[model samples]
Target: METDENIRLRQALEHAAAELPPLPDLAPLAVREGRRRRARARFAVATTAFGAVTAGALGIALLPGSDPAPATPAAVPSSPAPSASPGASYPPVVVEATPGVTPPDNPDGLSPAERERRAAHQQRVAALLDELLPEKVTGIRPVKDEVAVYRITAGGASFRMAVSVRPTDEPLAPCPDLPEERGVCETVAFDGDREAQLMAMPVNGPDTTGSYLRFSYGKSRVLLSVDPEAVSAPVTPRELLDVAADPRFLDLVEDTDARPVETKEPRPVAGG
Candidate 1:
């Protein structure tokens, strides 16, 4: 397929190649190319190092405080173990018995209408207490069932429990000067507008004992007392607290029917 023009071009190329001087040594060129590649690599490494230093400097400048030590990972708290029983979480707590007795105090001179209302309310509360009392603590009986007062005895434990509900303008009672030797008394904030006082002391001249939990809920105040000596198993502070915080009690306090009648002066009830 070679044409006349192709043959002429091929001859010209061979003549030019023969006429040219011997090819210069190519070792120098190869060495120069390698040097160029090495230089480029060095420049790239230096650029990368400079960029890393600049980024670190900028990060330090943007921090809020002065140069600080590197932060460590925070410790994560473990989840609490599941409780075996619902009551297991609330362990038994017994307030030690002490000497002397503090007779129950009553607020007197309520009007007959108020007394009637209180009596009805007391009966309802007694019913509630009977229902909520522990199963083993049996034979729940009311000794003195009146307006705002309930004295109850359970089983043959030989202990008496009294529950009293009344009206109070104050959210909390001031802490009385209590001696630690006698017993422990604590005043704690129950909620936003309510406070509670818990005292465990001896009753009936140290032979018997009592646990008193007094707390305010909404517009009403409640006092719960349990004589330890009257029962085989004395009620614990935990139990008292649980009872005080019962939703049913709060419902009773908020109930319109059970609300106390506000009166300026106390009036005596004929048979109250």
Candidate 2:
């Protein structure tokens, strides 16, 4: 039924189709590629979600009122330790001595052994005075070259005080003979037959500011005096007498009496 031209055209098309290569089946490769892309997308989504969750947890941990992290412990030394030394021996501690006062020579003509004894006794007495005195008396420093004499600082003022035990047959010092000079004199009785004379005299015969006490302890005359000329509110007489009555104070007097550290005859010292 076809004409010659149609027949020829159909023949040519068939020839061309036969000469061309066969088409490949791309369905499996497309499916594999789609699966791979889906897998990569799921992985990216999971990673982003994990990062966001980690960031949120960190932000909550760093908020105010959160507990702080524990601090790191200090590092211990690696070097070997040295052994401790034995305890050291120390001399007896005494109050500071007064400055600029030269210690006088042995005026009592005491033997070398006696001088050493006296020096030791004086040191004991000085230390005792520092302890027994009132708290107001800040310090009690021994005057240079003097025996039993100390420079006391009280209420920001410097004053002189003497505590001496000398061999004497003299009676307790009496109050001032002058009517205007006589301040307050009283007899204070202590335990046993012990007694002391306490006198408070005026600075310039009218100012009324001095403290003096004298008593006989054994064969020695115990004298206690404080000069409060310009000092305001000097140590009271009751305080001075109370100190003299202390058993510890009397014990020192007893020690000195047994082996006298002072001169039998009173000699004027430079500071005293």
Candidate 3:
């Protein structure tokens, strides 16, 4: 017996046939059309049966309060469309700083505690900067007062590091007032080869308030970065350190003879 659905389908087919395109061979075309329609009906019926079976299985598996385990959801079909990742929003991160205790200064203007504290503080900062690994470098230069600088010039950007000797018996460091986002003291970073480290620190006043940014790279973890001028402010010590430890970029480290990159203050992140 034809179901109500079949009756409705017949009426719909008649309506469509009345509107079909005119063909020259009516009888043969009609026969072909009938075959095509039957084939399509069979395909549709198979597809519908498949869908119903799938739905029923899913429903049985997903039944709530059932003693049996739930069914796993089916894998979504791959689409030609591209989708963005949620974590992609994390900006190219550089580093995070950790504060520490500083020691008192030695006579002659510097204390052993001050130097130790500053060095320790810088170390923490460097650890953070180490996160800036896998960076590209551009140029290297030597500076005055036993100093050198490496200039990084890639990754949609430009940055420089200054390394110098810390006053052994000194009071405060002899470095200069870094521009914004730079610090007189900073942390360190390890190289990809884990061979060398670059160091940077600021030469600013105690009242310095804004966040200081600095980094150092070294051959081993114990090596205090020989380069202090390499430091920049307003950046996490880690990123700057990443640039230092980068080898190809290390060429930018002045050969103690290469032309020095003109000194400039650290710039602020726009609308950051």
lDDT of 3 by residue, 9-91 (tens): 99999999999988686889889678645644543343334323322221211112322111211221122012212111101
Question: Among these predicted structures, which one has the highest lDDT?
Answer: 2
Please report, in order, the local distance difference test score of every candidate based on alpha carbons.
Answer: 0.47, 0.58, 0.31
Task: Look at candidate 2 and tell me the lDDT of residue 232.
Answer: 33
**Predicted structure with the largest TM-score when compared to the true one:** 2
Alpha-carbon runs more than 4 Å astray in model 3: 1-161, 164-189, 192-203, 209-232, 251-272
Off by over 4 Å in 2: 1-112, 173-178, 265-272
Worst ten in a row by lDDT for model 3: 87-96
lDDT of 2 by residue, 1-272 (tens): 89999999999999999999998889999996786456445434433343233222211111123211112112211211112112211112122233333223454566655544544555555555655566566544444335666556565455678889989766655554545665778887885788888878777536548888888977898888887746433677788887888777777788777767666855446697
Worst 10 residues of 2 by lDDT: 84-93
Candidate 2 TM-score, C-alpha based: 0.55
Q: By the TM-score metric, which is better: model 1 or model 2?
A: 2
Write the residue-wise lDDT of candidate 1 on 38-79 in tens digits: 644543443334324322221211112322111110211121
Clashing pairs in 2: 103-145, 104-145, 202-208
Q: 2 or 3: which has the higher TM-score? A: 2
